[model samples]
Target: MKVTDIVDKLGLTVFSGHEGLGREVTGGYTSDLLSDVMGHAAAGSVWVTIQTHRNVTAIASLKDISAVIITCGEQPGEDTMAQSNEEGVPFLGTTLSTYELTGRLYSLIS
Candidate 1:
């Protein structure tokens, strides 16, 4: 599935990096721990996290993540948004909790 498809399917908000909406989403990783994500998230995966810090973007980019979904009605930090755009990694938002988001995403992508 494409990032855009997930956004449309889940009613997610696109906070930044619209350019990456076309990117393919092969899988997903749900975590707030930077090191865990950095070490485990696969390339082209959509990362489901509550973290909004700029470092999330750096890790997402370094790990070749397809997108970052900020859950629980949270918003990304300004620097995070900027870095997301710069790295062409879509920064998405949602009001649902991580579990809800992950369940929905899994049903769609799995």
Candidate 2:
């Protein structure tokens, strides 16, 4: 599913990198641990995490994720947001828990 499609389907908030919502994503991974995310998230997947640190962007960049969706109503750190914008990475946020967001995203993709 396209990133924008998932956003619309799940009513997700595009906090930053709105332009990237048009991109396509084949899968989604939900995790708060940066190292776990780095190991698990696939290249073309959206990474759903509650972590607001710059390491999230680091993981996104290193993992080649389609986007980083911050769950649990959290926002990325200022530096992370700036890095995401600079790197042209899509960064979204939601009030839902990681489990809730993952289920919704999976439903949309399925």
Tens-digit lDDT track for model 2 on 1-110? Answer: 78888788787888776667778898888877777877777898999888877777777878888898888898887898888887777899889989888988888876
Candidate achieving the largest lDDT: 1
Please estimate how well model 2 matches the true structure, expressed as its whole-model Cα lDDT.
Answer: 0.83
- lDDT at residue 78 of model 2 (Cα atoms): 82
**Candidate that would win on TM-score:** 1
Model 2: which ten-residue window has the lowest total lDDT? Answer: 14-23
Report how far residue 82 has shifted in candidate 2, in Å.
0.6
Alpha-carbon TM-score of each model against the true structure:
0.98, 0.92
lDDT (Cα, tens digit) per residue for candidate 1, span 1-110: 89999999999999999989999999999999999998898999999999999999999899999999999999998888898899999999999999999999998998
Clashes per prediction? Answer: 0, 0
Candidate 1's TM-score reads 0.98
Q: Please report how far candidate 2 places residue 106 from its true position, in Å.
A: 0.9
Residue 1 CA error for candidate 2 (Å)?
1.8
